[model samples]
Target: MDAITTPQNRFVREKDVEALPPPVATGGPVAWMRENLFSGPINTIATLLALYVVVTVVPPLYTYFIGNAVWTGTDGNACRDEVVGYRVGACWAFVWDKINFFVYGSYPADLRWRPNLFFLVFGVGIVWLLWLDAPKRGLAAIYFFLFVPVASYALLYGFPAIGLRTVGTGLWGGILVTIVVSAVGIVISLPLGVALALGRRSKLPIVRLVCVIFIEFIRGVPLITILFMANTMLPLFMSEGVTVDRLVRPLVGVALFASAYMAEVIRGGLQAIPKGQYEGAQSLGLSYPKMMYFIVLPQALRIVIPGIVNTFIGLFKDTTLVSIVGIFDLIRTVESARVDPVWSAPSVNYSGYAFAAIFYFLCCWGMSWYSMSVERRLAASEKR
Candidate 1:
């Protein structure tokens, strides 16, 4: 007797789809500036202060580089006049005059090609390694472990295989010294750092204690003190009249200093690994060394690649400190150039420092960029 009619369903179609709110035009460049620069009292103050700084500093820098008058002359009096009375900017001519000695150092006028070739080979090898994603890793290991070092040593040491003449270490200076010290320090520190890190975490108390002591003692002291000790005490440690090569002393000091820092960096990576990794290796019946090499260390080392590169960059910069100990590194070469009778003005000294600064900046910046790229690659691989 009572039949109820059912309501028809409402079927939504494409035209019924709601549109997204109009793209927020509030957060683009102008909106960002409004939020960050003019949002509140504190933000306004900071923005104004930054603008004031730009107004005060940027123009003078621009004029110094582009508009300031520069006098270029070899005569000391003329150079002096360029800076005697008023505010003067950098004298780039000083750099132009002494650029040769800065690059080649006191290496004999005829034999600059040896160091230049060393740079070329090292640079090419590094670029090759960085650019090749699918390179034969085993071949790279062989090149890094066996071929590059031996070849570089022979070539730089003038072993007559490459038709290069023997150049004494004393002849090494400027960027050559910086490169040699950093390269040798990097080569030595990697293995030494791994050993030290392992020893610090060893089951043997004695070994752990020794490594701890070595790392702490080195880290506790300033690198300048270490360089001084290396320069003075090393000669005494050797037999009298043995005459340790001055270059060798600084190289040893740099390597030792770098290794200490590297050990701490590696230890951090090791600590970040879970204990399960170690226990898993043991459960698989792997020996201590085999377990570490096969499972633990590769992951740990990858974790620490950025840190390793940072330590390398630090050591590279610290090579400049050898100048204080009378080793003629790049900085010292620049200092020596400033003292040249032809370019002894204050402006010239400033220009020389600028040149050295640019050189250091280029190297350190490149290393930092490489470290960043490696970090990103590792992070992406982990995600996959």
Candidate 2:
């Protein structure tokens, strides 16, 4: 050690020692478990219990879903335990046979290609809009918000002027109905919700009161009630000869219901914004609309991205409620298909429901994963 002696400070040392490496067990799985799982008696006990439950539960689920699954069959007999000489798990053969019906419902087989094309366009629009680093995102927004909807309507409902056959909404069902309803709700809810949120916070008493009443009334009612009223009561208020399509009624109900909840979510984000933000925008001589568009709304929306995506996920799953109004959504189609006498077997019902569950889980999980990705991206941008 080289010592640097000062007249006022006699205890100073000049040399710096090299830093030592951490203990081998201090940076891996063992350290992680020690720090997180076994940090305390209660935590250690909980971890052990969770591990035991996983051990007990996962293997049986694995066996039922995979080991004993019937992969190929023409009908129910192919999945029957008696015919197979053992118990069975999933009946994927049934899913394979009914895949077309699950996708298209009673949509004419020739016209099925129309929905296929629509799905292709929808997929492209979604990818373009959702990919953060994509080029020309402003153009992507226009394509998604303006072009895709029009194109989808034309493709699905058809335009006879273009020699495409008119397909009634009554013929649409299954996954097609589910997607249409969810997409409409998701697309419509955000803008309408933002409007309502702003209105609720407006200085005008009339605007705030109207928004308050609307949001509360819609929020107070269950979605099923909204669908019922839309289905049975909404027509009574219309012009005597002006009939609303069955699908259109539920579409309106779902959109309105989702909008109310979305408004509340947005309002929460707005409330979280500091008052200084508003004042700063005003200091910049921005008009109310410009203030919101450029300064306030973006920050509020960014703060509430998770809530927005959660609402979307819930709305997507709630498309099943459309079935209560006699719509043939995915769950309705699955319920209808599973009762077929031709495919009757003990495993058929289980398989059909499991298939529905898997589809829903996958869709919801995708939304959740995308939401997390967006949140991470936004967070990174904020840190920068």
**Model 2: per-residue Cα lDDT over 1-384, one tens digit each:** 235465665666789989998766878898898999999999999999999999999998999889999989889999999999999899999988998888888889998999999999999999999998999999999999999999999999999989898999888988999999999999999999999999999999999999999999999999999999999998998998999999999999999999999999999999999999999999989999999999989999999999999999999999999999999988988999999888889999989888889999999999999989888888898899
Tens-digit lDDT string for candidate 1 (185-274): 988998999999999999999999999999999999999999889988999988777998888887888898899999999999999999
TM-score of predicted structure 2: 0.92
- TM of each candidate vs. truth: 0.84, 0.92
Report the poorest 10 consecutive residues by lDDT, candidate 2: 1-10
Query: For model 1, where is the 10-residue window of minimal lDDT?
Result: 1-10
Cα error, residue 108 of model 2, in Å, equals 0.6
Best by TM-score: 2
Q: Cα deviation in Å at residue 196, candidate 1? A: 0.2
lDDT of each structure? 0.81, 0.93
In model 1, the Cα lDDT at residue 68 comes to: 51
